[model samples]
Target: MRGDVLVVHETEKPPESWAAAVLLTEHPDPSADAPPWQEEAIRLLRDRWAGPGRLVVFAGGRRGFPSAAPEHAEGWASDWRGTALAHSDVVICRSPGGGCPAGVAGWGAGHDSGRIVLRVPARPAAGERPEPGGPEVADAVTAALAHLGTGAERTGVQRQVPLPIWRTDSFQRWYGAQRAAGNTLLAARPVWSLRIGADRRLVFYWALHAVVHVTAEDRVKDNEVVISRPDIATAVLYVPGATIDDTEIVLVREFRTAASTPDGFVHELPGGSSMRTTDPRSLVACEVREETGLHLDPGRFRAHGSRQLTAPMSAHHAHLFSAEITPEELEVIRGLADVPQGVAAESERTWPEIATFRRIRTERLVDWATLGLIVQALTDRGHPLP
Candidate 1:
């Protein structure tokens, strides 16, 4: 639950300035009953900020903060929802123009008004104590730590591990951050932790569920809850050079702020979660273009494979595909820097924050699990591997 520690000064420094007057949160409608945690979170936030800026709070809309602030407090609006959540927060920057800093770490970004709106991540309290041992939960937690690699359970901010071309640093940082936050209700591979429950019942972000069965007697049999995600579309696209062995991968490298990494961008397949549950095949075309500007005919993609990720803690499945990148498309992707996922404003984008980094070598750092699938796709298609 970290933030940028925004300090607005009225031509001078004051002890009470950091205390925000208005606590802003999202609501589909202003009249809807507020979330149960809203009031409690505000109370906690007030204590942390420590100044009686304003007693009144509002719960709706994100873009109206300028008009909503009181005259006494000309600039007093910030989002502090992370404090109530169990996980540590990471920073994200939004870029609308060719050069916007809204998305870089340790840097301020400019908005349309040429003003910087910095939303910095809050660093988690380091060295959280180990959980009390329970035979069942302890066993599960131990196994998860092993799969996640060393220092995953170590406190006081674990050091960064060298990212494989197959993995993103964001995931690694997130894993450590989750452990630092110490909310390990359910743990397993793929999904080291379950942030939210089924249909978002337990939390408001991720979907966690269990295999359930209802018998004729009306008695229910419930299995452990696991993570669920929108149907995903995965593709291992590559451009074939003049020589048969000159195949270069069509990959994307993007910064994921959730990992709290300045350089955690990973070599990833050009894919994304579904916008709908229908044929995921339709997603490849849009995702590839938005992610890397690599246009592809979805119809040309062949079904490479599918697999369940994090079998124990998640029912999340990824549908994998393989397609050949045309020479014209490769030219477009080859000339670019990485994309960074930023604010709520640009998050709804098809490519959100992604950049093209087509692969000429497997030696480039990659996200392992994803790279494994990509290699499989190539192997199935008889594409030569280095």
Candidate 2:
């Protein structure tokens, strides 16, 4: 069995110093306490260290840290209890004898560091087997460690400004006057692939250094302009009763006077007006519960991609995600008092009644508008969209 290993240094630590090496090992024997899929991982680590050195073996809930001797051969159990067998440099498993575990047969030198950690699954019995690896696994581990050793360089912070657009003849004239005054309006190039309707799409890009002023004509009477600075946001999509075959996606329908369509009703994915401070995934889950009355499993949701929506007057970037939900989860949401608020308003308006969820065929998904585009984008990115 061959598996990949990673060696990472703590970001807070000095660049020259090594923090820890993590080995994801597996056991082969079927009856072994660890799952069979883990065998490939263990073999990969063993092959990497063909020579004699300190190697810790962790099986079950045994302590494996605080070695009696600095360079002694010992093994210990990891402090945390979890099924995932991975370790960070700061905390490692150590054995009671203060040496690497005897279960680790072949060992070698890892990047020099004072602390070492080993993670093992909590199982009933410990299997005693001397599993060795071939040269290929060893080479693969070395290459993996080399790649992890490189640190990501910190880059300067880039600011984003949200420029809101309102429909007004006077504002257009003001823009022209500003242009004549040597103020150039920046427009983001349309992402050709994201274009949907035949109508030409436009973007209003503003710089942080520019001063934005809203004239009386620019404001709709009794309506305030709500412009949020451009920022990263996450959205989680939850579908109830979803499976490999039968899948049902969750959506919401709201009345929008701004929509030019006949019905003036907009079908959208469950999301919300995120203060640029929220993480995309967190926002999605939070919005789902707030708007549609659904409690979603955060772990099941996966981020797909992001898109910039540029209208001549306003612009925003939508972060997309996909998640799975069960019927039981939907029942819980239906009992809640308030659903997530997916849209924002600057003025008083009649709230649309919640539309009962209707299942639309995934193939005919394009029949819907805003959410359809989002689903299409996710599908194109190879994310599961139902």
Give the best candidate by TM-score. Answer: 1
Tell me the TM-score of each prediction against the true structure.
0.40, 0.33
lDDT (Cα, tens digit) per residue for candidate 1, span 1-386: 32212321122111221212222222212223333233333334333432223222333223222222232321222322221111112111212221324233222211221111222122223676422222322332233222222211212111111111002222433344444654332322121222232321121123222223333344443455444445567787776554434556766655565533336655567787642345768876666666766667889888865676555654456788888767666666665444432223545322222222234233545655676776677778775655
Each prediction's Cα RMSD? 20.9, 22.4
What range of 10 consecutive residues in model 2 has the weakest lDDT sum?
A: 154-163
Tell me model 2's lDDT, rounded to 2 decimals.
Answer: 0.36
Report residue 42 deviation for candidate 1 (angstroms).
Answer: 31
* Model 2 per-residue lDDT at 32: 27
What is the C-alpha local distance difference test score of each model? Answer: 0.39, 0.36
- Worst 10-residue stretch by lDDT in candidate 1? 157-166
